[model samples]
Target chain A: MIKLLSLIFLILLLIVGKKRGFKTFITFYLSIFLIMMYLTFMKTGLNAIFLAIIICLLATLVTLFILNGSNVKTKSSFISIVFVLLLVTIITVFIGNSANIQGFSLESIESIGYYSHDINYDMTNVIIGMYLICTIGTIIDTSISISSAMYEVHENNPQLNKKELFVSGMNVGKDILSTTINTLYFALISSFIGFFMWFYSVSFDFLSVSKSFDQNIIQLLLSFIASIMIIPITSYISSIMIMKNKK
Target chain B: MKKYLTLKNILIFVISLTIILFVYNDYFLYKTPILKINNIETTVEGYGSYNEKYYNQKITGVIKNGNLKGKIITVNNVTSTSGVNDEQIHKRSELFIKQSNNNIYSIIGVKRDKYIAILAVLFIDLIILVSGIQGVKTLLSLFVNIIISALAIFVFQSNADRLNLLLLYIFVSMIFIITSLFITNGNKTKTYSAIISSIVSLLVSFGLSYLIINIHGRDVTIWTMDYIEYVRDYENYFYVCILLSGLGAIMDISITISSSLNELIDKNFKITKKALLKSGREISKDIIGTMSNVMLYTCFTPIVPLAFLAIKNNMPLMRAINYYGEIELIIVLCSCISIVLAIPISLYISTYILKKYKKEVVK
Candidate 1:
C-alpha cells in the first residue's frame, strides 16, 4: 500500500510538473525503470517485472495522453533522458547485483535506520543532484544575463557588427561578474562557518585538517569549477542562441 | 557663531575623542595587573599516576617567551598523596599558581572589565548619526532574524543530530519569512501569502526529499559523519538535519519566486496565471542554476581540507576522487531536489493565495 501510494504521489508530481511545461515527466518514466531495477535485485523475477513494466507503460501513456516520443521534436533530448536512466540502472546493478547476498534486503532496510553498518559510500544520486543544481543555476544566470546584455547592445547600435556585440557582452558581464563571484564566496563562507569554528577550536595543523576534510574540498572544487566553467559556456550558448534566434 | 562650532566638525571631533578615551581607559583605567609577557605553557607531558616515580617528579617547564619562559622551573620532590588514575593525575596537576614580584601578583586567569558604557555610547551615536526610517527597518529585521535563529537553535533545535537540525532549520524559516515580509510590506494580504507560500513550498520540498531518498536511493548518509557516527538508528536524524541544511536554499528560491509573482499580479491584475508562471520560470531558471552551484560549493568549501589530504598523499586520483562523489552526491541531490521542489510548491501556493484574495486585491 505504501509503495502504491508513493507511486500515485509520483504520478501526481509528474502531472503537476507537466501542466506547467517544466518537463519532469521524463524523470517520472525513468523512475519506473529504476523501481523495476530495485525490485529485480530483490529477486522479484523478470516475469513480475515484465507485467509491472507493461502496466506502467500503459499508465504513463494514459497520463501523458500519448505513447513514446509523440511530442519529441528532436530525438536527442529523448535519447539523453533514456541514457541517463540506463546509466542509473547500470550503476545500481554493479553496486548491488551478481552477489548471492540473500540478506542484502534486510541489511539495506536495517541500515535505513542509521545506515551506519551497511551503507557504503553510495552517494551517487546526491552528488549528481548537487552538481546539476549548481551548474544549472549558474548556467541559466550567465546565459540569460549575457543574452540580455547582447540584445541591448545590438538594439542600441544595429550595425555595430557581431564582434562589437560580443565585446558589449564581455563589458557588461565584467561589471556584474565580481558581485556574483563575491556573492557565491560569501554564501560559501556562511555555510562553512560552523566547520571553520570547529577547525579553529581543534589544534590540528593545517595539513592534518586538510587531510581530514579532503573529500569536502574536492567536492567544492568540482562544483565551483563546474559553475565557473558553465559561466563562459552558458554565456556563449545564450549569445549564439540569441543571435541565431534573431537571424 | 556657526564658524566657531560647526555641528559636523564637533561630531567628528567628539567621536574621535571618545574612541581615544576608551583606548586610554583600557590601557590605564584601573589597577589591573600588569602581567609581564611571560612565556605560556603551550605543550605539556602528562605523566600517569600509575607511573608513580614520575608522578611528583619535578620536570622543568618550557616557555616560549620571557627569561624564565624556556628555562625549566623544576619543583623539587613534590608529592601526590591522592592515588587517582594516571589521566586524572595529569588533569589535576596544580601547574598555575600566583607568583608575586615587588608586591604585585601575576594570576592564572584573565582580567575583567565591563565595557557597557562604551557600547551604550556607540549605540546612541549610531541612532544619532543615522535616524532615517529605512535604517530602522533594516535594524529591526536584522534583530528579528538573529533572535529567530537563536530561538530556533536553543529552544527548538535541542537535538544534536544534524538531520534533525535540518528539520529545525525549515521550521525556523517560517519565522524568517513571516518576519521579513512583515517588516518589508507590513501585515497585509500579500505578506500573508508570502508566509503561506513559504510553508507550502517547504513541505513540498521535504516531500521531494522523501521521494529522492526512498525511491531514487539518495543516500542521506553522504553528509558529515552520517554513516560512521552511528551505533544506532541515527540515519533518520541525519536525514532531517541534511534536509534542514538544504532548506535555506529552498527558502531563498521560494521567497524570490513569490515576491516576483506577487509583484506581477499587483502591477497588472489582468495578468494570467500562465504569464505569471512564465515570468517565474524565466526568473527561476537563472536562480535555480546559480543556487544549485551555490549549494554545491557551500557544502564543498568545508570539506576542502579533505581535498588537500588527497593532494598531500600520493593517493591515486580515483581513490581521492571517490570520497567526494559520496558527499557531492548529497549536496547535489539536496540542491536539485530543492530547486525542483521549490518551483511547483511556490506556484501552487501563490495560485491558491491569489484565489483567496482576488477580492482583497483591490484594497
Candidate 2:
C-alpha cells in the first residue's frame, strides 16, 4: 500500500512539478534518511543537543542551498533561519529543563512497555532535539518566503531604502503569518487526533487531560511559539542582508 | 509619535513580564494539591539483571493547596536518568501530590501548566506587538477554529459508533476551510474564489485517495499505531486521518494559487488566461516543494525517536518501519499527493472564475 502511494506521489510530482518536483521528491527522502541517521547517532551517546543543532544546520543547507539553489535570497534566509534556530534551541533547553517534559507520555509507554529502558541516553536532551527538529521545517519555509519576496520587492523597486525594504518584508510576513500559523496548528492537531480520540475513549476528565499537556500539547505550543517568534527576526535580518547586498 | 510608540512598546513589555511572573507563581490556581519541592536526597538503585542505575529520591516539599496549604510533605520517587516513565525530581519543582491510605503523600507528575501559560502569553504578546490588529484577528480565528474542532471531537466521541468518521470530518473540514479563509481573507472575490477552489480540491483529492484505499482493501493493523489501542474501526479512522492531515496543505495550496492568480488579474485585467496559468504554475512550483516539505517533516519527525528506540532495542529496520513508520509514511504521501493535485485544480478554478466568467460579465 505504501509502495503504491509513493509511486502515485512520484508520478504526480513528475507531472506537475517536473524537474523541481523531482528535486523535491529527492529532498523529501533525503531529509527522512538524514533524520534516521540523526537518531542513530543519538544512540551512540554523543551530545544529543549538539548533534541535533548540527543536523539541523545540515538539513537547512540541503533544503535551502540545494533545493532552492544557492542565491542571495537563500543565503540571507539561511542566515536568518540559523539565527532563529539557535535562539529557539536556547528557549527549548530552558523550557525542557524547567518543565521536565522529557520522556514518553504514559500513553506512549504502553506501546513500548516491553522494550528495555536502559538505553542510557538522557531523554531530556533527546526531547529537546526532537523539538528542534520538529520546528526547523516551518522556520525554513517562513524565512525563505520572506527573503524571496523581499528580493522580488527590491527588484521591482530598487529605490526602496533599507527601512522601506524591511517594512515591506514585515508586511509580507504579516500577510502570511495567519496562514502559516494555521498550517502549523492543523498539522499538530491532525497528527495527534488519534491520541485525542484515545483520551475521549478512556473518559479522562478535563483536568487530567490538561495534565497530559506536558506530553504533546506542550511540544505543539512550543513549536507554534518558536515559529511565531521567528517571523519578525527573519523579516528584519533578511531585509538588512538583502539591502546590504545591493551596495 | 516615536515617544508614543516607545511607550506602547514598554507597556506591552511590562504587561508580558507581569503575566509571566504571575503564571510562574500561580500555584493557587490549580485545584489539585501542589507541592513545592524544597530538597531531595537521591540514592542509586540497581534494577533488574541489567543493573540499570535508577535514582530513588527522598523528596520533601510544602503543600500549596487545600487543607494542608502550608504543611510540609514527604514522598519517595524512583527515576532513571533516561526519565522515560519516571522523572528525576528536581528541587524547586512544583508537583501534584495524592494522599495514599497510609496517610503518606505520593507524587504525581510535575505541574506544567504554568510553563504552558507563560509560553502562550509570550506568543500572544509577540503577535500583537508585531502584527497588531491583524495578529489579533488571526488569534481570534484560531480560537474559533479550535473551539469548532473541540466541538467536532465531542460530537464524534459521543457518536463514534453511529457516525461515519470520514463523513463527519468532511463536514468539519468544510467548516474549517470556509471559517478560516473568511476570517483571514475577508469577503472578497478572491476569497470566494479561494473558498470554491479549496473545497473542490479538497473533495477531489480526498475522493481520489478514498477510492484508492477502498480498491487496495488490505486492512491496516491499528495496533501498531500510537495511542490507538482503544479504537475499534481502523478503516474509518484511517480515512479520517488522511483527510484531516491533508486538509491543511491542500487548503494552503488552493489559497495560495487562487489569491496569487487573482492578484495577477487585478494588477492587469488585460492579462491572458495563458499568462495567468503560467504565473500560477510558477507560484505553485515555488511553494509546492516547501509546502510538501512541511508535510513531510511535520508528519514524520515525531516518530523518529520511537523508531530509534525500536531499532536500538535490536528490532530490524524493516520491522520498525512496519510497526511504527508505515502509517505516518502513508499520511505524508497522501498529503503530498493532495498538495500536488491541488495546484492544477486551484489554478484552473481560479483562472476560470477570475478571468473567463468575469470577462463575460464585463462584456
Q: What lDDT score belongs to each candidate, Candidate 1 first?
A: 0.41, 0.80
Per-residue C-alpha lDDT of model 1 across residues B207-238, encoded as one tens digit per residue: 76566567756433344432232212244443
Screening candidate 2 with a backbone cut-off below 3 angstroms (N, C-alpha, C), the clashing residue pairs are: none
Error of 2 at B341 (Å): 0.8
Residue B31, candidate 1: alpha-carbon lDDT: 30
Docking category of candidate 1: incorrect
The two-chain DockQ for each candidate, comma-separated, is 0.04, 0.60
Every model's Cα RMSD, please?
A: 17.5, 2.5
Report model 1's TM-score to 2 decimal places. Answer: 0.44
Candidate 1 segments whose C-alpha is farther than 4 A from its true place: A1-247, B1-143, B156-170, B215-237, B358-363
Tell me what TM-score chain A of model 2 achieves.
0.93
What would the per-residue lDDT of candidate 2 be over residues B1-363, giving only the tens digit for each residue? 676578778888888888878877877676678888898999987664334578789998899877779998789998986766678877857888888766698876787777787778878887887788899889988899889988887888787789877788899999999999998888877787888988998899888888777799755675666656655455677777888887777777777787788777767888988999998898889888888878777777778667767776888766776678788888788888999999999999888888855532242
